[model samples]
Target: MKYQVMHDSGPRLRVRAGQWAFTKEEGYGLASLLLDQDFIHDVFTSYRNGSILIYYDGEVENKQRIFDILDGITIDDLFEAEPTQTQVSKEITDDFYWNISGMIGRRLLGKWFLPMPIRNAITLYRAIKYIWNGLDSLTSFRVDVALLDGAAVTGALLQGQYDPASSMMFLLSISDELEHYTVQKAKSTLKDSLALNIDTVWLVDDDGEEKQVPAMDIDKGDRIKVRMGDVVPVDGKVVDGEGMVNEASMTGEPLAVHKTNGKTVHAGTVMEEGNIVVEVYSMNKETRLNKIIDLIENSEDLKAETQGKAERLADSIVPYSFLATALTYLITRNASKALSVLMVDFSCAIKLTTPLSVISAMREASDNRMMVKGGKFLEHYANADTIVFDKTGTLTNATPKVVDVIPMSRRYKRDEILRMAACIEEHFAHSIATSIVNQAAEEGLKHDEDHSEVEYIVAHGIVTEYDGKRAVIGSRHFLFDDEKIKLTKTQEKKIEKEATEHSVVYLAIDGKLEGLICIDDPVREEAKYVIEELKSLGIENVIMLTGDGESGAKAGAKSLGITQYRSQVLPEDKSRIVEELKAEGKTVIMVGDGINDSPALAAADVSVSMKHSSDIAREVADISLLSDDLYDLVTLRKLSVGMLDKINTNYRNILVFNGSLLVLGVMGLIQPATSSMLHNLSTMIFGAMSTKSVLSDRDISNDIEVEAIQVADAS
Candidate 1:
């Protein structure tokens, strides 16, 4: 609420403060009566900036008119006007409100309900005790967030960190036990196609002390210096210097990165850091780390937001004797019986179990060579039915072997022919060029010094004077397009075979086809298994997208069990394909790895980019797999669906527990302390249950008893 003293005479006024929420809600402001309006714009005209306070005039209606501009203000519009305030305020989590409410409830109990001083003291003491109890619960949550990876609730149980809270309790509350079983799914795994070592980076270093022994080691409290064309490594404050940073990674804002002090910098963003110095606000572990991790892991669960209700339920319950209040109330809603049951509705079941279970599952996945950034993603992995794949480095081995090297004339032997080709190719860095170089090296053909003056023509053939023939070697289309080199039947047949196999480039000499080389990039061994497993998990369509020509795309698709293929697509066109699929009512999960694949990756309903992919691609992608294992999708899909079920179950459980406990809370049998314990317990139980789905029932059944014995022995 906003108020101003009429010259600070009648009464003292507090400075107005807008409650921290987005403009989608409303801001605190007092209106003037200039035009019989209750809003701030009755008299004063508003400037483009959103700050309406200092802009107020002496006329009350004028003041209201000026402030009325606020109603037109939204987060999107504000960013356009002010442009710097992109921080959409995050509503404080339930922990804050419920804790304060519990205090208020305690004070009410002591002052109005109790007559005896001793009773009042005891009541007040119980309320004060709950505050510390809440802190401990919060501490446990903090620890879980720090060490946990994968689903928010499932991955937190590795060390039995919250052992007193039954882990399976969450499961019982969150999911109906499954009744079906399955084995080997999908057709086959797609081939691995992630190319290693083909990235360009522009590094931005904070602290400005590169000489200070391992610069990343130094503690940063000062402003970081991120110049133009550099990747911002960590979230920092603009303390010292700045330039325009490309903030497309975080906000999807298509603007020059503006520079100002006190602005937050995110990792994997480019400095476009403009001309200002900002301080380092948070580093690797702190900063907006949790939020970013949440974006990666949480797969749109509408239920998890009820965390506040869980806390309030914890605060509202009364101390009770042996019987569980929540269950008693559900069975019979008597004031005394329900209060006792409400005391047992400790919502810790929701808070503790899910995260712990996910953490454990992620740890397990890691043991099997997968790194999950957070548990929320693991929990949702089971629900993802569509899996898209990038062609180049993800499905096919980046390296291709030269299988057939034919020469037009017997005058040139294979080795000499390859040596000349590799000589010209060495000047270029295209995929085919690298393949030729690698093949020549494999054949032990030494580099010749004579082919020194080589020039690479982008999107065309390489031209070099090898033995002074003005050799032009590239695509047959390149020669045809140049309208220069002609191919004889012998050379034409050879070129046709090479091109048919998807080998790039045609060798031409003295305006005539010389010979052709066939290079084949074989599919990864794991491709077949991954594809089959994904199909089993219910991926409706398995398709391949590539810039590789149709023959090569079809060959890879056929070999890897893909029925649909798009070849020779430009980078922008890949996302377009995904758009088409979405138009057809498909929920696509685009998996890609390349600097060129960023747009397509972002366009997919759920994006999965290999960790080894381009930074831009990874930054834009929804899910970043840290390895080139196609089979990992099985684990991801399994866990994601499982977590969604758990989330669903947990939500139902919260409603059930609260539905039963609310009656008890209204009655005298349920008091604050016991209710808090029960509430936290309920949260913990639900949390544990949310995590158990990380492994299927069969997987768990197969190893439990024996593993339990082993675990006990180890302990």
Candidate 2:
């Protein structure tokens, strides 16, 4: 295994091994080997070119060690892989079977013709373990439900009621196992929902030759060709060809989008029509499903306030159960009555059901292509009164089109201007830049890289030297104000005439006004409907923020029926606006999809990012919508509200039913064994019910109609 250094820059190293580097099995094997080493921080392998990019945490001295390890690797030493589901199921099944066998053995021993002394000794040993657990809880000053369960079982044993004690312990063991099974089942479903099943892909090489290869072997910057019925294997930009892509996996949209050259495409999206050649940007990017799973697994710390209250209330009632048991003994002078009081504990049901309901709701969200980071985000979303949306790539379609290209100089043609602009814009990934470059490609305007290194000014424009002449393409402020390029009166009138209701990107070359490219960014089809739905869901303030001019914002707002809008907002201005809203005591849910929106996203009570959002924006957001549809926001709000409602309903039912049983036990109306059996039965029943799906067809229809009616009435 010999390798050549392809790139070396500080902690990051890129190494390639001739033509034998990456096979599907070998790539994963290599990644596994590198991940096992302490010096390596991350490893990304490309099967297309047999290249590996490694990021390490240690000093340059560790580089030699990494090379040594790579040199020592052989084909036979590669680790074998197993399906995750098989491993998970085997482990769970083994544990379950072991527990079932123990329970069966206990039952058989009791039924067999054993000596009375030996049988009594076995029963005593089990009772002593329960009593010790109860004593330990008391010593720690924690009056939990466990202490009550142990006390009831111990009391029954002490009173020579062996049957009742054995029954209590058996039911408890079953309850514990059932809880474990429920959680594992939920997790399994979630993992299956997020799994990517890609096996093979069509790879296009530098010479424009195509061949079939394993998906894992595809590398960043490799050209991959996809046809109708094929799922895109990586996130990339379309370099050539056109297609209608059904992005339901990412955006939840049922319709296919018309994607062409220069438009960005994502992994798992199906190409429904035509063909496309995509230049891969990220191979093995983190999937939304994996992120959601991480969130669900680590969400215990982010419990809703209601869930915390339920737990606190459960703990608070423990001492009351103990007091009632003592009083019952003093008044009735019967150990059975006191034991009944202890057996019907309320804390167990309250603590168990709340978290289960929250987790179930999260799983439901994942099914709907929404990833909620924690239970607390759901709570915030439900309570949000105001919703703020970034105008571009959120409410409007991110892929704007070039409608009119105006050239100032007779020396430059519209297509020539477009080709030059596209050549420079191809280096950047902004939505506007993408639109310019894509439009040029559609018109078959091919231009080579004739410019020097381009300098990108954030939120301003691009500066570069083309053909030994200074060239600039950006906003009016960047060209006229920053670069001091003057616009003639006649040129200004032409610009004004062409810029009606469209965003204009100015272009200048050699200190002279070259031309402008006017882009039309239409509002998303579902944007207005989503806004109406939010109103019906009780969102009080719906506002729009944009970096565009006041006229543009006003036109967008008027069309969408949004009354509150702020125009020409900078990155920091958006965050300030969110802060101001928060100061007004409004819970804000901000939706955005660009790097500029990251600050405002962080400032919101809860933030949502679109499927096509920039990395920084998504990283800061609490929720990520895998689709570009705004309707999912309404869907999410409904799910969150329904979850809170379900939790509250369970709480009420638990209190009423369990409180009644406790009262009946205290009055000696029910026997100790009967009370314990009924209480455990109800807890198990409700716990199972808590895992049910939150959304129903009827609920969705009703909510949609309600929103429509509200919008009509307001009109």
Task: Score candidate 2 by TM-score against the native.
Answer: 0.70
C-alpha RMSD between model 1 and the true structure: 20.5
Root-mean-square deviation (CA) per prediction: 20.5, 14.5
Query: Over the full model, what C-alpha lDDT does candidate 2 score relative to the true structure?
Result: 0.80
Model 2: CA > 4 A from native:
1-123, 178-300, 408-413, 477-497, 511-513, 699-715
Q: State the C-alpha lDDT per candidate.
A: 0.52, 0.80
**Cα distance off (Å), candidate 2, residue 513:** 4.1
Best by TM-score: 2
- List, residue by residue over 624-675, the lDDT tens digit for candidate 2: 8986667789889999999999998998898899888878887889988888
